[model samples]
Target: MKMTKRNGVFAVVLAGMIWTFASCSKDDDTIPANIEGNAIEVAQASTIAKPGTTVSVALSFADPGNGTMLVIHRDEAPLRSVPLQDGQTSYTFEDILPADLEEGDVVPYAFFIADEKNTITSDASAFEVSVALYDEITIGSSPVYQIELPEDGIIETGKVKLAAGRKYWLPHSVHFMSGTELQMEAGVELYMNTETGETYDVVIDEGARVDVTGTATAPVVVTSDKLLRDQDAEPGDWGQFNIKGEGNGSSSGHVEYLRVEYAGDRGFRLQGVGSGTTINYVQAYRALGEGIMPTDGDVRMKYLVATNCEGGGFRFGDAYAGYVQFAISQTTSFYDEVEAFTIRETASPVISNVTVVGPGEDVDDTHGMRLRANSSGKVYNSIVADFPRRGLRLNDKVTVTDLQGSTVFAYSYIFNVPRDPYRDDTENGNPFRGYLDAENVFQNPFFNNVTGFEDNDEDEPILATIDGIGTTSYIPQTVKNSAFNPASIHAFFSEANYVGAVSEAAADWTKGWVRDYEGNIHQ
Candidate 1:
């Protein structure tokens, strides 16, 4: 469990790099042939830097004969030209990024060496690091910040309780060993120290647990410490919050009213969790990986929402059996075909009263609910809408066969999916292809807010200004099943008379928490 994900520590090629030449290169500014005196190669992987932060790089030079010049170009323009002494082969490059760079903006650079006579040595490596906004929660403002934590940031034994009203920071990845319980009180904000080191994750080892007790008014927040002035928060600002084991510890893995923002990996990952765990009113906003995922677990959750996630919103894998009710996953402006719900690896979860919103029509072929890898699940009283691709997709024949063999996929709604509402991606002609459309509605669920979706530039963006099943009919053909009774199923489910995540009769659960379309956190 060595969860080390630091930036600029490894010498690897970045994702988007421009290599000028494989063997040797000739450019207009270089001597084309002969004088093979100098060569250099980039020695740093991609990095994530905040505004006004130093972007560090390493370059290894080869055989600089006597006196040579190393020229660094930024975006194809010469930024700095350095004179290397004889036999200077290694250099650490550091530059202060401009504070005005926006999110998702990349700064590309390359280098060339001249041996007395101008000669191109090496092509440009890939882009170095990316600039993003950081959270502005400084430490040591009050008593809560003065609480004595382990100097090495490891909690091995005993129960630790972190109260509210002050800032919390993790220097690096913090590890909670077995028999340890970390209790986070309400109104607590945990931020990772980007200035010191990244990979500021919370790892609950085997037999360890975290009890997060937050309320709607004072929810616990896990975000970046780089959200300073003129900086915007992006996903993967910090590492993950991983909860392991069967969750049998005392009140372990019991989280409520917690909001995780801009987490690098999963916001909250439950691995091998069981029925003893409890989760309610949890949100994962703009996660770099899956927002909320449970693997090989029987975890149950309610009032869960993941919005604008770069990764899939709610994913379950490794034969997970969970109960998800009153959940929603919405994305806007991303075209990566990131699914809202990805059920894979033979997972079988009972999902009810959910609304899955997909990215816009500019995206490629994708799906809202991707049922694949022989995963079987029951989706009831849900709404899958506005997907550019299929609403419910089956990736293979085995997946389609498993879906048909599983329990109910009825009493849901599928709307505005231009690509076939239900599609067999493998096209194996499985007989159970239409299992997702049984007794499901095909009309608009937001009938009360038609004008809200008429414009994409409005305040609400792609999602409706107000989301609810106003006039949409939820004609359930049968009553509550015996399996969902108080004695049989997980007792987290209430009788749902509506089809979508929100009801016209009750208050929206996302009002006090969750981020809006403008990237503003709710108060």
Candidate 2:
């Protein structure tokens, strides 16, 4: 029977050996009350790998007698019986899997009995097995392929073979080979021009490497196809410039002095399944989805920037134990800017030297900082500013037991309530919950050479800077009306005793990054 319902990763391959069953001769008068049938047991294993990766399966079963017909089952879906033609006796299945699967991992299968009506079904005969993935490319054997975009066109979808020592520029979606490490050579420009409503613009699968290094004067840039002034090209309108390693695998690459902007899904989606990856000196601008989504793996990010994302600046989903230092989220608005850092369920991220500007909206869905339910994290030496609504909201639904710091204990300053100008969540559709006590400061979070940061006009945000003891930042009003002008706003979180992430010491690292609208580095 065929069912018309379906929904959905890469797959891993399994190793199996063929085992044969000996047929027992039966007497001519041998008969039973119930009709007997043959059982063909199939054991399958799979791993989540990149597209075009190899996946293998092994089949073995016993031959029961019911006039002798062999039955087989693939996974847990259904079973089919194969008729004996000549003398063929064994079965084998193997192929390279696609991108979309069940949670992008292994599946279970069984092989069992057949009824008199020729239907094959298994009860206690099902077994669970899995196929795993491995990196199989030799340096000289499999080289990297360069993806060059035509000046007049966009490359949508295709596979390209890259030479190991060469650099490539992509104009659209390019799926790379597995078990291969390809460098995005220093000073390379990978451009993407995805129109509205296009599905999955670009994907970097497992076993592939990208090294886009930029110096202080000339950094590599991966940007959208549309011009800088186009208003219709928001982050969520297209797919993602995704960097993902699927199914319990790890990836290692370098993205330094690079700027990725106007992403549809997320500017960067890094998953550490095998061995995690590393990102340094990267900037994400005007992203649509979560600016950077790190899921279930080990990753490290240093000297990064995320500005003007629709949802939030940066989001950590599951198991975000990555190393992040010297980061800045200056101003984010135009959509409901929630928490500067959203630690979802079962995720713990070590974040330091962060800055967030609060939006001044009269409605719901605007928060400077919010620690959601099932998320326990430590936020130290950070600045949160200009919250037109609540400064910070620790929801009542969240278990207070896992909080790292106390609500009442103030180091220099730890604020919970907004000033008189901001409206409370209860006033809007977003209700205020929990004990967000006022009158606490871990440290005196001072603004940059200005008065309070406020959102006056619905078309613009108020900008200023905060320079106190260990923290210095340019804090601004974060509302739907906020703008991402480099001159008006700036932020930085540093590891050493420095003012910003990119100071004079690291000036030589980002040599190729373009200047902001005001002819300055987008700090």
Top model by TM-score, which number?
1
Off by over 4 Å in 2: 1-171, 195-200, 228-234, 246-249, 273-276, 360-365, 396-523
Q: Report the number of backbone clashes for model 2.
A: 54
Clashing pairs in 1: 17-126, 134-226, 134-227, 135-225, 135-226, 135-227, 236-264
Worst 10 residues of 1 by lDDT: 469-478
Lowest lDDT sum, 10 consecutive residues, model 2, at 13-22
Give Cα distance to truth, residue 68, candidate 1, Å. 89
Q: Model 1, 313-364: lDDT tens per residue?
A: 8898887887888888877656365677888888888887777776654467
Report clashes for each candidate as comma-separated counts: 7, 54
Candidate 2 per-residue C-alpha lDDT over 334-375 given as tens digits, one digit per residue, 9 for 90 to 100: 466466556666555555545555443433556666655555
For each candidate, the alpha-carbon lDDT, in order, equals 0.64, 0.45
